[model samples]
Target: MAFVQLLVTSLLILVTKADVAIDIENASSDVYWIGILANPGLPIPSNGGFVLNGGQTTTVSVPDNWVGRFWARTGCDSGTNTCQTGDCRNGVECAGNGGAPPVTLVEITIKGDGGQDFYDISLVDGFNVKASIQPIDGTGDCSTAECESDVNAACPEQLKDGDYACYSSCAKFNTDQYCCRNELNFHSLMIIISPRVPLKFQMITVV
Candidate 1:
C-alpha cells in the first residue's frame, strides 16, 4: 500500500472587503464538492461556477506501520509578471495594459479511510489556508503511533501588495500504503472576468 497527498489553490480579487460570493455551478457524479469564499470581503455576483469530479474512487487499504497526510492552498489569478495577460486579471477596470485583481486563498483537508470526507474551510494566515488530519475517536487508523507535527503543515502568507506567494509541504510516511483506500483528489479553478477575458473560467480536475 502507498500514501497519497493532494494540494489545490485558487485566486481572485475582491472589489471591497464586504461582499464575497461564489456560485457552485456543477460537480462530478461520484464525488462531493463544495464552494469556499475567503477573506470575508464583499460578496460578488454569483456568476455560476462548478467543481468537477475527478472520476476516481476514494477508498483503499494501507500497510502496517504506514501513515500519511495531504494539504493544499488555492486562489490567485496569476503571478506578477504574467498576470496581466490571462484570467488572473479578473476583468477589472484598469487604466494600464496589465489590469489584475487581488489574490485570495483557501485550505482543504481529509484524514484516514476514504469514505466521503469533508475538509472545512478555515482562516489560517490572512485569507491563506491550513489543513490537517487527526485521530478520529482518539484512534486514527495506523499500525504505529503517530504525532501531529509529523503531518504536513505548510501554510503560506501574503507577500507585498503586488507579489504572488506559494507555500506548500507534506509529511513523510513510515511505510508504503494503498493510495486507493480513502483517497481524495483535487480540482482547482480560476474565474477571470474583464472586458478582455469576458468571463473566461478555467478549471483543472485531478484525483
Candidate 2:
C-alpha cells in the first residue's frame, strides 16, 4: 500500500548575459523521490525527511528573468512506527482492525512549467500516478513582461466541487479569493527524497 519514487530537475534563466549549463539523468526506474518548489512559503521537508537509494545530485541557481518548477514525493513512511492513538482515542470506536484508516503518504499536486512543466499526480480513489522527467539544460532567461492571473480564494464549505484542497489546520483561507499568482521569475529547483527498496540518491547544492 506504499510505493513512491519521483525525480524532477529544471533550470531556465533567460536574461541573456551568457550562462547556460543544464545536465539531468535518471530517466526512469520510478525515480525514488525528490522535491524542489520555489514558493508556497518554501521549506517543505518532513514527511519522514531524507530518503534516496542511489545516484542523486541537485544544483539550482536560475538567475535572469526566471521560470522554474521542481517537485518530488516518494513512498511516504519513515518507519520506526510513529503514529499513536490509543484505540482511536479522544472518541473511542474500535471495530475490526481497530478501525483502519491511516497508512500515510497521499498528498501530491505538482503541475509543470519553468517552460512548460508536466507532472500531474492524483490519488483519492481515482488512482492515477505516473511521474518521470529527464531533460536538463541551463541558461535562457528574458521573458518578463509580466502577466498574472491564478487566483482562487476558496471557501464553498471548505470546497470539494472541483477538488484540489490545501488549507485546513485551524482553517483560514476561505474564499477571501486573492492568492495564487505562482509566477515569480528566475528558475532553480532540485529535490530528492528516497526510500530504500531498490533506489537511492541524494545531493543538494544551491549557488
Candidate 3:
C-alpha cells in the first residue's frame, strides 16, 4: 500500500509541473489532427497528440523544459489509420516519430537557451493549414507566431489538394531550388523564395 501511494504521488507531481499549454486552432473546414513529437533526449507524456474537427480549438499540456515540434495532419482515414499529410505511422500518438514533410511545423523550446522559452512557426516544409502559438499568461517575449495566408490558392492545378492543401514544390517538381539540393552534381542553389511570392510569371527547369 505504501508503494501504491508513492507512485500516485509521483504522478501527481509530474502533472503539476507540466504547465505549458499548446493552444491549437483549426481554421479550415476539414478535420485536423494535433501531432506532437518529443525531441531526442527528452520524453513527452507517453500518450500525446489528438484529433480535432474543423473550426475547433484545443489545448495540450507540455512538460517543462520540453522541446518539440507540432503539426497538423489532414486526409486521414480513421478506419484505416492512414493520413495523406503528416502521418507519423501511428493512429493518434506520434510515438516520438515526426510528421511527414510538406507540413507546416510549430516548434517550441521551454526553459532553454539562457533559461527562456523559445517558440516559432515554420514553413520550411511548406504548408497545409494555418496555425499559431502563444504563451498564455507568461513573460519574456511571449510573442504570437502565426501563418494565416493560404498559399495553396495559388498552387498550380497540377499540385492542388482539392482544396485541402498545397504540396511543397519538391513534391511535385523535385527541382534543385525547391528541394534545396545541388544542381549539376556539384552546384548548390541559393534559397531565395520569400514567404510570399508574386503572381508575375517565372520559370524553372530541373534538368
TM-scores of all models? 0.20, 0.19, 0.67
Residue range 102-198, candidate 2, lDDT tens digits: 1111222222234432222211111112223222232233122110111112223432212222222112232212221235222332211112222
Lowest lDDT 10-mer window, candidate 2? 96-105
Give the alpha carbon lDDT tens digit for every residue of 1-207 in model 3: 000000000010111124654445565567766677877777655355678776666656666777877777888888988688778888877777777766767666667779776666665566676565555556566556565556566666766666766656666577766666555434443432343644221222210
- How well does candidate 1 score on lDDT at residue 98? 17
Please, what are the lDDT tens digits per residue for candidate 1 over residues 1-207?
A: 122222223111111111211112111232222222211221211221122243422222222222221112123122331221112222221112211222222222223246322222221111122222222322234222111121112222222222232211111111112111123223332322224423222221111
The parts of candidate 3 lying over 4 Å away from their true place are: 1-18, 23-29, 46-48, 55-59, 156-163, 168-207
Mark the regions of model 2 whose C-alpha exceeds 4 Å error after superposition: 1-18, 22-55, 58-64, 76-174, 177-207
